[model samples]
Target chain A: MTESAAAPSGPGSTAASPEVRRNPVSTHPIASLLIGLLLLASIFFALYVPLYGRLTPKVGAWPFFYFYLLAFMPVMAVVLWVVTLLQRRFDTEAGGPR
Target chain B: MSHVNSTVFTIVVAVFILVTGIGFAASRWRRTQDMMHLNEWGLAGRGFGTFITWFLLGGDLYTAYTFIAVPALVYGSGSIGFYAVAYTIVAYPIAFIFLPRLWSVSHVHNYVTPADFIRGRYGSRGLALSAAVTGILATMPYIALQLVGIQAVLTVMGVGADTTNTYLKDVPLFVAFVVLAIYTYLSGLRAPAAIAFVKDTIIYVFVIVAVFYIPAKIGGWSHIFGAAQTHFTSTNPATGKPFGTFLPTTKKVGSTQLDFVTLALGSALALFMYPHVITGTLAARRRGAIKRNMSLLPAYSVVLALIALFGYMAVADPATVASVKKTGNAQLSVPYLFQNHFPSWFTGVAFSGIIIGALVPAAIMSIGAANLFTRNIFKEFFKPDATPRLETRVSQWASLVVKLGALYFAVELPKTFSINLQLLGGVWILQTFPMLVGGLYTRWFHRFALIPGWLAGMAYGTLAAYNTSSPTASHWASSSDIVFGFSLYIGISAFILNLAISVVLTLVLRAFKVPEGPDETLPRHFTVEATDTPAKERASVTAGEARPAPGV
Candidate 1:
């Protein structure tokens, strides 16, 4: 971390050499796409009220709407957890964390 | 005077003092050579780890408003109130996508406020000023809502409910706010970040116990849901209509399904834009800390989902209902339920939790607003040569002024008004989305075009909110109104209008070959890690924090 100060800094590198490290998105397109999908899915299940906003189906005494929201929390946590790991891997792979 | 629970009152006061002591002591927590820099005072030296970030953000986003107002809404209107739950659920993923980018950029550039980022990205002072002003304007009512939350707790404890004289009635609330303002001015962001630990612990203990114990006391989870279902389904004698839906439905005229979805989506987007939440995110030590915290912060939402059901629990316990009926304020439902069911000693623990919950967010918000004023408004426009010492001092005083303004809003406005004002705040802050969030990914938005887009959205949202009338109040009665046949949150509606105008005008401006402002940030700057930036450069970046790039 302390060695960053010694690294060639700023937009100057882009003009100086063709070997400049690209932005993370271009460097890891597949991982970036997967992260986007994971995020969008998390948001989708959450906001699509019709998917879980009902009462008939019950989980132990919770109405389905209530149960779904509670259950969705863990699912979201796991999904974002996966994305975080992927981001860590790519950040390291893309020239070792900037 | 109304009957005061001595046990509850004592514990509440004791907890208040404990946290107040903690707030002042926090300035020394991560000892630094100098406290005058905005980096130290306003951003807590930007060294918070993942655990502290989780608690700080949790304490920040799930506020006293979430505790008191959300349940009150649920108690009054049944399932529509759960939009808060849905809103919180979605806020993480949305923030997960944009916030890390913001964190990286701000760390690289030493941008202290969202408005600072706008100024750097667009190189437009007027647009940045608009962002700063909107942030401070939107945040006031939100701080006011926190005070109102504290007031609800006090009123239920019967501390001032007996007094007919208004001044006398407000003395406890006045004392509380003054204490909060003093510590916040003394310690800045550290005050709230420190107090958040104690506050969340107390809240977790009480909420979990209340969720389980209260259901057991009031007859089991099935009975509570059953009772709520039955009550919501029953007709109101005065209106000759059902109280509210037990579940959000697509069948109604002003369909709640659309309202639920829009409210959840709009609030999720707006939550991160609030300067305070941004302040919380920017305080972390590393960009990765924010993403890790995003997954972890939803733990608070599970607690929030349980808290919202306090409304249903209140419904199931008829004595609690009858008591709230006499007060004529549904915000008292949760407080009253705890007071009625829990032993007085335990009730004291819960009441203090709610009070401290209000204080933590209130402190962070004022600090957030103050940072915006110091960085974007004061330093940007008035004092370009302001020293870091001067900036921190100015921010301290600005925080006090912001808190005082919020106190006035809480004391003078109808108690119900703050909720809508907060939603109206969401309406106003979401207008900045195109400029702040949009500028992150693309510079295609013409700087000049964003101004009118923001103006149109703010004007339309304010007027729509002002003219909205409910059965009880003449104006500012609701946050949602009919927007093209669907009952949607006004913030979402205005955001669409804002985005459309920006896109249309950007095209025209591009066609005309108008000059785009200088962009200070490089492409890699948006993805730069803390470890990537040199410590010396990071320390010096604040010197030119608001200055535009030298050239394109």
Candidate 2:
């Protein structure tokens, strides 16, 4: 565990100790931006009613409204996983302990 | 009472006994050296890893109510019930944004509850007290809702007494509550975390089997949906309106598309703010564990979506619908549907799953409430020099008191009252969002300003909820209220009012040069993760020395 701390620290850590590795979200703007956009897209997809609330299209005996919401669960899992991965890029870039 | 299936009842009893044993034994499951601290009792030592945290949170968020009531709503209404699914889906991304920060800051400062963080950030015990009180209030109904879930299962099982006296009628529920209280007292948060594994597995197995097997046994998915559509479209003789909506309607005056959107959004915002959810989050091992679980926890939401389909299944099966209508309780739709469709032994499994489902979350909720009382109320106000052992002891006894308060809610009140109170609990808890979540990212909002903002949100939410009524009840009938001819979730509307008040008051307070309370946190503190050894040191140190500044 101590050996894993040998990473270039980001700005989050003020101690400047050799053992302390910073969390990357504090210094990585791109990661924060990507995560911010993903959050917005997620909220939009969830809250936008007219987009998928219609009943014409049915998938596998389920109404489009129900299917759209159900499908968004897995899609949300994937998008959040992508965000986690994007955040991970900062961890690797800063060589911080994950 | 209807005929009790001996086989099903016997199996459920057996499973209940098995879980009770596990709950008692969990005290030593992940044994820490010092067991008398609040960290061990209230948060399972705050050392839960990714896998354990996953199961624990999955079991925490998706409770017996989600299993029973979401489907019950779908059976009663229609597409509006699917708002639960949307709320859960959106809840993840929202949690993804704030939970890591919360975990990090709490970990660094050894904050035990959200109110502890509030007190530290805003330097106001008054604000912290408000948050603490709201958490406990919101949590009691939620815990009672879990009991209602158990009652629905027991009622369907023919075990509930058909008597005039409430105590005689609720003997089974009381017995279950006693066992839960004992085990939770013995094991604390570990009791729930350990038992969550069994509860979730049974739920998954039964829900998956019921999803595939029951539809085929009744008719098909197409047949079920078609029946639901037809039934909901037909006019009811009593009210002269359709039974429910096949899809969310734009033309409707009350239950329109906007209500659906607001309900979903409001519920999503309220989900993570609940004290039990925060307890689960704060118990995780690392910052990354929280993030990983957030991305992964929506798998349970998929299960929830499938569970919601059972409402349509109940609609498709005429016998189940008839039985539920005969009882005048839509909450029994899922249990009756399961009993009618599955074999006696499988019915036992499903019933036990729901009952155990209630137990896990109830234990967690009581613990959350107890922690608030111990940390924010008891220690903060009355006992300044309380020791770690005393805190844990007080929290243990406090968990019992909290459970009994929830029991009063479940027994004394009507089921509709309890359910609506749970919704009202959502509205009340969401008022804390600006102060708790806002404090995480910024401290610009004056601490004094937040107090009035909280007051405004609480007053508006309570009055609006009190004024709104359905045909059945007078006060706290529904969570949404009409605003500008559009029905909106009261939580969202109140939250908007809360933020607007806070912003205006903050500017005024700033101009008048009101002294902002000392912010003990640095920016870097929000991103720090706990090292294994330092976690123990911090836990012991904070347990001994932590106290809010005097006379804030």
Per-residue lDDT for B385-486 in model 2, tens only?
A: 888899999999999999999998899998988898898899999999999999988888999999999999999999999999876677787788998888
Model 2 chain B lDDT-worst window of ten: B543-552
Scoring model 1 with DockQ, what do you get?
A: 0.47
User: Candidate 1: lDDT over CA atoms?
Assistant: 0.87
DockQ in order: 0.47, 0.42
Tell me how many residue pairs clash in candidate 2. 0
Q: Provide the overall lDDT of each model, using Cα atoms, as 2-decimal numbers.
A: 0.87, 0.87
Most accurate candidate by DockQ: 1
Cα-based lDDT at residue B147, candidate 1: 91
What level of docking quality does candidate 1 show?
Answer: acceptable
Model 1 lDDT tens row, B1-552: 548978888898899889989988988889688888888889898889999999899999988988999999999999999998999899999998889989977877778999988988888999999999999999999999999999999888888777788788999999989988998887888999999999999999999999879998999999999999999989999778889889888964443898989888998899999999999999999888999998898899999999999999999999999999998999999999999999999999999999999999999999999999998989888999888899999999999999999999999998777888887899999999999999888888999999999999999999989988866789997888887667888898899999999999999998997888767676566776666343334655534433333222
- Give each candidate's interface RMSD in Å: 4.2, 5.8
The C-alpha stretches of model 2 lying farther than 4 A from their native spots are A1-27, B162-164, B540-552
